[model samples]
Target chain A: MTRKHLSTWGAVIFIAAIPIVIAANSPLLQWRDPVYIAGGFAGIIAMALLLFQPLLAAGRLPGLSLAVARRVHRWLGAALILSVFAHIGGLWITSPPDVVDALLFRSPTPFAIWGVIAMWALIATAILALARKRFRQNLRYWRAAHSALAIVIVSTTAAHAVMIEGAMGTMSKAALSGALCVALLVALNDLRVWKRTRPGRGITTD
Target chain B: MTKLHMNRRTLIASSGAVLATGVAGGLAPARAQSLAPTQSMRGGSNNYRPGAPIVERIGGGGFWMTGTVRRAGDGAPLSGQRIQIWAHTTEGHERDWHSHGATLTDANGVFRLEMPQIVPAFGQPHGHLAYDSEEFETVFLRPVMSSARDTTLEAHFVLQPA
Candidate 1:
């Protein structure tokens, strides 16, 4: 990798790892049960994965070729989905009623609303991806639908991550959330998902 | 390409500054409330029970949970409203069954319960109180004590009817 590529990768890794390291060292986690801790860490990991996603899709990350990047993106997507489930499931086990309230959109924290919205958007995007063969028929429509959900996921997840003063070290969490938004914005701008995406012309490795 | 690189560098540097500031400020200690109705908090339902036994006091008594329940707009005292209370305590974690209890407001809408001293948990010394009964719009309050050393933590609820 060139200096540019090396720096880009380093920055990505730096932003992604800082929160996990901080959260792992957080004293608050010592007071929490294993289930809550698992849930909390899964949430942190999910946010880090979000940072990789758009950069991968935009083929902006170092080393991985576009096709390889896209492939890794899919795998990471699966990992992201599973992490989200673990995050919610672990929390649900720890406190069913609170999780229920959050799922039902009655959670009192400002973060809960944003989290629920992002969670649903992520789920919806996953569902669409499953049936993306149909969407591949019309690249423009697929990009529109995918990009729209991506925006929702990016924005609301950022809101959700930042609003809660949780086990995650605050600064790293804020920085990660900020990077996630920037990654999505950069990806969207580079891909021009809102504009034409004629088949075979959507994603390319120049 | 240069501009994008500069942007990324700036982002990384700015984030570094934030991390430095946060560490200096004690790693973003626990704080804040809200986004709930007036005087009612959103996470109030945390550690709540629908019918925690109406106890003389929460177990391991030393701390007091005191508050007045009243109508939201008019401030009329709401008698007989069940206020569920729980907290991580010297006796047990708030998630423990024993650390939880309930009490009802008097004719004057005042309710008080004693429980074990609350120690700092999740980076703050706090207690949870909820008005989960159907009598009022449900409200949950997680009020942080200014100091864990304080013996009494009060949460006043001005609630709307369910």
Candidate 2:
């Protein structure tokens, strides 16, 4: 691989690993139970996957074809779903009532509300992805709607993740959250999901 | 048995009342109007023990783990509420059971426990505190000190109705 290629991969790895490493080094982890730690790490991994998701979708990642990227993105999306489920499941094991209240929108904690919103949006995004062949009938509308939902997922998830004062180091968490937003914006811009889905423009060929 | 607790009661009884915001004697806050229910931060409860013992002091005293306990919204002082205190200290890390203990709020809604001086861990000077009473929603506070050299760390909790 070329120097540029190596550096590109390096930056990606750095963004993905730094937050998890800092959180692992947190002094607070000593008192945590095993399940909580597992759940927490899963959430962190999901965030890291989010950083990868948009890049893959926009074909910005260095080494993959659009076909390969699309496959990897789908698998990563599935992994994202599983990671989120594990995240919630772990917390549920730790504190059932809090999770239930969050799911029901009755939790008083601000983070829970944001988390629930992000989660449902993610499920919706997954549904859209699964029905992509059918969505081809109105590809502009589908892409635009998918992009909008992706924005909601990314923004609310970032809010949910950043608001928590758990194991993640604050500065690193903020940096990761910032990176997630930037990645989504770049992907959305490159993909041009909003390019022709308007009042004046007709549906055009890709 | 309790210097922090007894001193507070004595000061309140003798003075009848004191200044609102000043750290006069053991009063935590007369400014409860500003207190809001604290959100339990994610991952803040890492090393929490469900029933840390109510101790007069941890590690034979010197450092202070102090704060106010009040009801959310109204901010009424929560008398007798159990507030568990723990931290990485001069003696050991917060993960050590020896570094953990609990204390109760006085009639004024203030609670303080003596412990060994807190030491910075992972480059931050922080102490972990929790209010896990059945009567009130749980709150986990991880208050970081401005400097590691400081001797006292405070973490107030404004709990919502359960």
Candidate 3:
């Protein structure tokens, strides 16, 4: 009902549904390349923060509480980074030519570009957070940077899902798409909350 | 809120019941679908029998051929299996899907024909299948076996790539 509630729920659902949504896509599972698998796992973990944040903020917990949720959110983020590397490495080992094309964004499909963009955004977000100690302690600045990059990561991952047409059968596709929709809704809810909370602020509606 | 909780309980129970029923109903068809005739169904071990004169010729491949073929389903040697292999390219060009190179199998289902030099095409340039009844369709054949073959020669095949 409230913006905070919506944001918390949205982030939790996003994170929790990451694996389910990715598994929905058939092609990802068929070949069993470490690269794609790792990538999928990482993407899910990254997206999970979107949902988990809201729930933690709302204080909906019985065990370990918000601290554990924050830890999970951070750990999943790290795991996601590692998984993405594994995914890229696997692809390089499996098909060097294809990997080259994917990196150059010259692959026959559009998903390559989306995947690459997502990776870059993820790395950028990670870098910002990691360097927060060196940087000024501006909560608004950190939040804006993190949220923008996170949105890009989720959006690109969703695009990757839409473009891939292999083993992730129809059910998998539907599941991932459904999850993406939920994440998008959560993001939109965040925007609405921001607008209501800070009228006439200079936050660009990206 | 109490009513909402009650409705949620009812909804959850009904969904669980429906899911259970759906799973129970779905298995038969799923099993049957998986069991349905795939390409492997056309040939199987134990179907090939011995006792007929075995002819060994090099099929297309990097190495010499050494294998057997038998009658479809029965394993009975057609005894002098005259196989005419001809088919379209892997690209399914205008050449048609029904024609591919062929050879014959003796009592042991062993027969090999030398492969002609084949130029690589955009997809794959090789003989395919021509005609067969619904019960027995002619399938694609590669000159050599898959494990240790690289030369795309049409002869001296250790096994049929199929």
Candidate 4:
């Protein structure tokens, strides 16, 4: 309904779509191709949007009209989910075993563990956000935890891209790095916003 | 005919399926011995001539894995351990190759491979081998040393927690 609500659903949809699409193919998929590239881009955008959602929700960015940011954030979250699905689906179709390893957190490679943990964290953060109203829990605690997880998501996703020996090359790495930087900046802005609201201990009530 | 003859006598009987097709010498053997396709008489009593030195060894597994591959006699790390591992289906018929396919050991004569439980069916050969969903298997280890060095190689196995 509202932009925040839409974004929330969008993020959930993305996370949920992964196993569905990967299982879509029987044999699985490969990574060295365009689908994966596009999916990577989409993932970056989706992460960017999810990170921005909080700032818009709290009315942090002034010039970038709060309403517009909220809308973009929602759409981006949906797009992010789509990207994740595409990334995993493409991989599954080409190399299902790799996807299986990634999903099960049994990948022998270094980045795989970080990626899996980040994925689970993203899902958890989304759920917490969605149920915030009903739960009546402390918003600050949720916000802090969400922020910490967001950092993990960005770093781990970047590491995933960086460590991939095939399919992803220089361009993908550059793009991933740039997007990560943007997410970091946006996160910093959100922190500043929260700080301004608190004006004392850097804890925002609203 | 001669190549085939050489393969039957020297390669299959002695090398154990190495050199898929070719061999070092074109010299035809005088006689061919009856050969059986079974895991018997490894190295044909030549007494384990080690393989080439391993340049690198990169091992990884499911968040945790540990093992040692060494030259059989001295118990020292076989610097050039050429270990190949594969997991097989419970029936031991099909190869879950895509998931638990062949893996090589690293320079320290050690390797750990983190494998996915499910495998994608590709053009993988039938009846190969793979890791089982319920259990793990240590497949193969061929230590590489020079012809001059008399060597023995053994690999230890470790499986994930059930």
Runs in model 3 deviating more than 4 A are A1-64, A184-206, B1-162
lDDT of each: 0.79, 0.78, 0.45, 0.42
Instruction: List TM-score per model, in order.
Output: 0.72, 0.62, 0.43, 0.44
Clashes in each model (backbone N, CA, C under 3 Å)?
A: 6, 5, 45, 23
Best by lDDT: 1
Residue B48, model 1: Cα distance from true site in angstroms? 3.9
- By summed lDDT, the worst window of 10 consecutive residues in model 3 chain B runs over B41-50
lDDT tens digits by residue: candidate 4, A44-104 = 4444344454455444444455557656655655565566666567556544554576688
Q: State in Å the error of residue A146, model 3.
A: 1.0
lDDT by residue (B22-71, candidate 1, tens digit) is: 87875664343111233456556666656788999877598898998867
Candidate 2 overall Cα lDDT vs. reference? 0.78
Tell me each candidate's i-RMS in Å: 3.9, 8.6, 16.8, 13.5
- Candidate 3 CAPRI level: incorrect
The prediction achieving the highest TM-score against the true structure is: 1
Please give fnat for model 2. 0.00
Rank order by lDDT, top first?
1, 2, 3, 4
lDDT of 2 by residue, A78-139 (tens): 99999999999987776565577789887646777898898999999899988888866787
DockQ per model, Cα: 0.14, 0.07, 0.02, 0.05
